[model samples]
Target chain A: MTGRTRRPPTGAAVLQPHITSAITEAVLDELAERGYGRLSMEGVARRAGVGKSALYRRWPCKQDMVLAVLSQMSVPLAEFPDTGSLRGDLIAGLGAVHDWLTHPRFVLILPDLTAEAARNPALAEAIQATIGTPRRQLASAALHRAVERGELPAGLNLELALDLIAAPIHWRLNVRRAPIEPGYLEALADHLMRALGATERH
Target chain B: MTGRTRRPPTGAAVLQPHITSAITEAVLDELAERGYGRLSMEGVARRAGVGKSALYRRWPCKQDMVLAVLSQMSVPLAEFPDTGSLRGDLIAGLGAVHDWLTHPRFVLILPDLTAEAARNPALAEAIQATIGTPRRQLASAALHRAVERGELPAGLNLELALDLIAAPIHWRLNVRRAPIEPGYLEALADHLMRALGATERH
Candidate 1:
């Protein structure tokens, strides 16, 4: 047992880059087809055209492999443009999120993470760290820009501002189980900008 | 061809009432015990101490059984009170919903329902008809009462008002994977009421 104990990351630790990337792709595809509950290491190995022993040589279990796959999905901040307007920035960010939400792999992955989270509260933090924090920060930055430009209220709250822009798309996908049509997106962006727009005579 | 085409509302249909209650209890316990998919129809039947045939007789499948359980969770509305003020009425009504959202079942059920909704859009409608419509109407009536009392603008957009309140709960439960904590709910209700609140300035 002592032989396999872990230590803090060292400057010279060897990483198995090829196997991990190949396995990650295979696992994602398997999740899209079979969903989380039915996914097995054997299935992933078979699909990746590798032996079971080869997979076990890398990750100890399904959760570890899954985390490796999910961690690869870095939120690309480059896509979030600074269009010199808060609403424009928000619209771009929200629109990019639309693709991720509707991906077949996501539909399968999210439920399992949350279902596992009920028992392991720590996993909730993991999910937030991986996906939620970056998302809110991106929106918050755009809102801050708006506040600085005097486009919003004097006492406008940042967290609440993020929530305001974020909640609608979240609702559209999660609850409605429908796409936010372009028409609705236009309406939502227009309405939210107007709502947050300050009174002219104030 | 018509020999056994019809359901007795008895074989599976007749036994539905008994198993419906049993399944509801089973799901709650199983969510605690086994998470979701580890929950098998055979398992619920075995635990309920009934034959698998009996469960099959009542529910065509697991989805059907879950749908019945969800319909029963009326979750005690906070009695959208007549506080005689727009802010008061909106806050109280939203506050009540916020409390109901704290239940663990909402987290488990909402994602399950949403996943199923992706497969069966008709089930989505059934869920809405059984649950969502009434929930919306309940909040809408409270807001409508505010309009009637001359406390809010008479033309306050009802659908938008419902979205303002309802969307946040779904957002927190589904995306944030965070509990709809009271402070967040209060803040949401306060800020939303201000944003969507009917104008009184003449």
Candidate 2:
């Protein structure tokens, strides 16, 4: 009776890395093709060429699976490198934003996910926790480093600055669906430096 | 045959203003609740308490119907009022953007339409034509006036400047689902003036 009571659930096996990768690709593809609202577990499993049990082993439902894959890809993609100067850092950070928003699969998936998230508040909160907060923290750390180095005002509005830093690229690529012209990112970094009241030499 | 060709086609009757308003409200309500993909002519007709022929009388298809309703609401909303200085102009223009984006119906409808537009190229083009271009032209006229008034540089990058002016607020309200703090719009305007190299006094 004790042994039977202590037994683990049947589908609680460890996920294989290859299967995880395949599932990730399938989630993105499914999102791109059909969008978040229409995505189904069976569809993802079929696309990944994995059985239902394999998916249940990793994530119990579609939202969990999608969020996990998205978080794994997005959180690290937001890493703001230590480029020594605030200008260099802004360029590096916003450049990552540009690349992510312009990535072929992401270009399709993000807007759909955003639409879905707006409708589903729980999903919106989940996304904020998994992706938005962590990404903002990385960028915030970069700005904080700039403040310590005397590049920005100690009284800087970090919340507003974060929005200013990334919104232009996002607006251009995602909302406008426009191409980034040459020298645009460097100019954007310069504009942000001034916008944040950075004291660095031009 | 000549007389028949000269005669007007069926369903070519002029639209009633009250019926148009009802249909417009129904379209927005339907879009907010069900999104663009799931919206149907029959559903809209049923919701508006009008017959299907009324819709077909105004627009031959669903895409055209949606676009016309969206255009009517969105295009005029982008008007940029002249406030003499570039800073004032930016504040007024972006304040309008803030109002439009955060409007209860638009808050729900915009993201869904953006997602649908991303997937449908024809719809995207239609939106660009009816909403995006007209809105940009109004803002562009404001910038052109600013150049004339010597508030901004003669060589200002208008396209980038326009993107900068609106993107931050859009990002804060729509993408981040964050609130605008007190004095935020004035601070944003100041930052934009600096970003644009405005010669006006701070």
Candidate 3:
């Protein structure tokens, strides 16, 4: 694999705010190894080889730190594989969701982010910037495709259909706490298609 | 509204395990008041009006102490509503979910609990016990009811069906990190009924 080479060094490293990205990756590894509750600023600082003061200067605390970790883990909705059909687009979109959220690191990190968001609006904004944008975009895309194809009737409340497809999958992982599997994707797709007035012939 | 009346205490004031329960409740309240990142055991003990020694005698560290706080908030699955008919019953089950999980205290508390659980098995187990049991009971009840009602195809995979209804919902709150609204409940109930090869017609 080719790696990007940087230009010759300038006066001082700008720190580009990307140092947190690398440090956060190390923190995620530390989390997988040590677990979220057990993770510490001292431990992450040591593991990332950055001074704890540098870490705190940016994060202020672990909640902000953890949200940064989660921000990177979210997949963008625009990344959906497009092949020109609503059925094709949806299966790919839901399938991507299946792959992204079910990972162990995500499951662990997200709850902390949500908890932090409940108290800290700044951290919540970061979370929204990274994760929520993608989630909403995907839903909007699917609904737009349906309307364009005349599959969904005019004035058919697209947001509600979006909720139908996504909300069930989310409910399972968060409240019901069940395993994500292939059958679930199929079921959700099947139900959502019918609700959107799309036929299963695809 | 009737209130629970407390009986007069017996003469001797001996230490008991209930103090652990009381302390855990206090910590949970503090967690809601102040975000988990700001949570400190000394603060907890101060709020609990207990000596630090008393708190330390129980859990070895902050992780274990928070784990105790989470463990108490869990509700038993035995309360899964048994109202007749799959749609009615599932809605009731969902309502039970809303009552415990979406309740003001729990909505904030759960994200922290889940974050803690994702990295810790014992904590995951404790969280899952509160989460999984109810879904299992609801799914099992629905499957059995369907079979008895001749609504489901014979020899259907009840477990997969359960996961279908379940996993999506789980991610909605924890991953998408949104609240479950009334319309969400209705769509889920309607979709689950039809997907399992039953009638959505009331």
Candidate 4:
């Protein structure tokens, strides 16, 4: 065994990051073009200009690859701005959601992934853990700040309040495919504040 | 040629409704199991225990077939109750939505079809025309009644209100997969009423 000379790991080491990035981009493109149902490791590898072995090395299957890519894209976009008031904070937060959904990549990717997640429980779990929970937490933090400032009632239903903050915009843009008019977010924020019993402190 | 006796269209004519019903059920099952991307006329026909010609006789393609089936299922379910009060009407309307979504077939079919509609513009249009429009009309009627009864402001934003009524339940059940509590709908209705400026007349 000592007589056999081992090849150096230099080439594989050098190509790893590049290969990973290429595969990630390719997976997203494939998801955008063909959707999750039609996406395959072979197609992703071909699109990435890498061998299938490289893809298998990174992800065991298409679902894992998709989850990883979505997590990478979504988590970074979950930033919630701490505007001075609850109303300001909500408008800013929802505006971010609007921008994210309307972005070219997500416009194509979200619907497909949502549909896939419906049929695939494992993917749904990954989505909630990676994308859904973090986004809700950030929005919840905004509401918590409002409660602390006495802008909202102390016993406000936080879960329902979070749903209110995000659901309308999602339904309009994604479900109804309707356009959001200018000044919509501010109006929405006003309505949400009223719904949550937010009022000026005396 | 005219002398040849007509077969009286006995077998197919007699079996038309049964065959149509069978194919419709098959399409829903196929959508639930494989989703829209993988659904095919051939598979639907096979599942229905009918020939491709039979399916072709009814609809031109898969899109038309799916749309027809969904329309049949959705239109009947769009009935909204006149509960006399804005809050009551909203709870009733949203309760219907909740029931429809949680129904066995819809639970399986809606997510996949929604996902498919996102990718396919033509399908989206068909869905909006068939399923979306009627449901909105019914819900809107309830709100209009509230306005007439002076429950809500006359100049309230009906479009936004409509989105508010339906979006949260969907986000919870479908997007978040969270369970609604026993009194959740009533509580939600209260919040929505406040948000939409619905209050008792002077």
Candidate 5:
């Protein structure tokens, strides 16, 4: 279906928002079909009904396109509402992670991209710069808030704590492909609070 | 280096152990070079200096060959000596996981194989059946020993506990590409015991 011929976008359709969204969607479709190892700008352009120049103007390389699309998709999803308690915030935050990992497009895209990143150092750097660092910062904001509110130890290892919050869910949903039973997030939050030495407000 | 032509093995070198080890090593080399997506039986045969029949005799397809090689490499590495206490056993077990993820061959092989497994259901099943199940069983045996020693609650959720042990290290070392500082494992073991509600033995 992605290989079907289509008329190129008109001059007016070359607007940044229009063409950028089309290209991003096309990249996701291509990744789902071809996986990241085989994804090409040519393929995305064809799939988006745009010319190669349109893609090249936007992102000079596949890594750029992939990272741009991924960051756009994931960064906003990383934000967790201030739920007033570390327990509440963690449960809310991990629930968002649960939804994202179980989402159909992400389920297909992440493993392939992660695999490609392992082999390509430039892409790895791009991913960390664009996706990994920003997302972790957003997640860490919650812990910073918790520390300010006297809910956690000031000396908490924020880096390790962030990994603790996200990794088990990822390992279960992505690696083990297991179901997250109802109330799992609450239990996980409790375990995490204990692991990080969080104290509840009186 | 893997692309260099080699003289075919002599009739004497076709002995089972010799040919099997050569093919298995070639699979790791090919996986590290070409990754699982592009690896092929022909490449393995060429890399191993064996006839294609030598490969077909062992595996019906590329996935089979890959899973076979990975199983051989990982299952033995999964063995962790029982260190008597749950804390000691966990530290020892997670250390093995840390080592395997950092090992050069596995560092290259794991992500590619994981990505391939995400796309191919049969390969996923083969991986889970061969590598995942056996490795988890070995890890679980340590927990079973701990439970017998009365070091953990009888109601411990073995699956979640296992995920807790492995996920942070994987996320840190593989996903985030961060360094595991010295003494980190000991601290991680301490945190894990608390997270799992272990009753420490004085």
Candidate 6:
């Protein structure tokens, strides 16, 4: 059997990257305009200039489609680098969060989807599995590294620390819909360092 | 002129307290089920057993009606009582936020409305004016009281502090969708005391 014919049943033959990009953009635009509660597969298909079968081949249903697209868009947005000092790492982490929250498309789509998830139990579970869990795990790595470097206590409350690290920025941008001013990330990181019981490096 | 004839045009006779209560309940129920984007005047009126006129009489449109109902329900949820110390005040304030976020109806409604507000500029403005501004002003008093008591620095960043005060709890409840542990509030308050640069009380 040739490698081309033996390709896994991913339907890679049908689901081209460029087509996937088009569908992804359409999903976001539709979600932004109509919200998750109002979003329909037909609308997405129409907007993406693809047949319903094209979407079906990729995802079983609307919920799966939305979750898959959002997971791809979100999971990589907050990359916490090893900046040596915990303060530097936190500041860099907060900056990543700030950038992701304020992204032109994301700023609109996220709050709406989160709101939708509040009312949809199945959707909520899907979000936690795909978006929330993975994002938290990646972000938790920075804190784990800080602990290894003797920057934080071994008995550190990792769950609470993770919450503290991400929540403030999320609240400001998503809930309050407020703008982040100059030096806001630095100030927030410093405050968080104190809050987490970490010794200041500088 | 009789006092009845000269009564202000508030339609107080038609908008009796009991009727208002029914309408308010209906609005909340409709919002919880259908969300802001899908909520309609007819649905609310039908749920309340009132005519559409009853709703329009209260507010010019659905946006105004939903905003009024939510504002009445929310603006009072975050009352910051003076506990005579910064840590005490913050813990008390965090408890209030935790209660509001976890309220059965609000737990379902707030995130949905916040999402809708992101897309609807008019709704966002009304919410800010009616809900966000009043809530912040009330919570801010706790910090001001701390400053007066010399528990906190006068140069404290009030806006950032306010964001810090509420964000973590809001994040844990609304975004993370996780259960807060038994000692979470107290722990959060202590951490916040450090973050806000307030001296520990005990």
Model 6 Cα lDDT, one tens digit per residue, A1-202: 2347545576455557777888999999998787787799999999999998889989999999999998888888867888888998888888888888887778788888788777677888889999989988988888889888888878887887888888888888888878888988888888888888886565
The residue pairs in collision within model 5 are none
Q: What is the TM-score of chain B alone in each candidate?
A: 0.72, 0.91, 0.66, 0.88, 0.90, 0.91
lDDT of each: 0.66, 0.87, 0.64, 0.83, 0.84, 0.84
lDDT of 1 at A105: 73
Per model, kept true contacts as a fraction are 0.26, 0.62, 0.36, 0.58, 0.52, 0.68
lDDT of 1 by residue, B39-130 (tens): 78888877877788877777778766765666566424646777777667767877776656556666565665565565567777777777
Ten-residue segment with the worst summed lDDT in candidate 4 chain A?
A8-17
List DockQ for all candidates: 0.28, 0.62, 0.29, 0.57, 0.54, 0.68
Ranking by TM-score: 2, 6, 5, 4, 1, 3
* Candidate 1, RMSD to the unseen true structure: 8.0
Model 2 Cα lDDT, one tens digit per residue, B14-96: 66788999999999999999989899999999999999999999999999999899889988888888887777788899888
Alpha carbon deviation, residue B48, candidate 3 (Å): 6.5
* lDDT per residue (tens digit) for residues A125-201 in model 2: 89889888899999999999999999999999888888988889888877877789999999888888888889967
Chain A only TM-scores, each candidate in turn: 0.73, 0.92, 0.72, 0.86, 0.90, 0.91
TM-score of each: 0.75, 0.91, 0.67, 0.87, 0.89, 0.90
lDDT of 1 by residue, A126-197 (tens): 767766787677666777777787777767755555666667765666565545665565555655665566
Clashing pairs in 4: none
> How does model 4 score by TM-score?
0.87
Q: Which digits, one per residue and each the tens of the lDDT, describe model 4 over residues A27-136?
A: 88998898887898889989999999988787778778888888787766667778778877887888888988887777878877777777778888888988889888
Give the best candidate by DockQ. 6
Candidates, ranked, DockQ: 6, 2, 4, 5, 3, 1
- Which CAPRI level is candidate 2? medium
Per-residue lDDT tens digits for candidate 4, residues B66-96, read 9889888877676778867777777778888
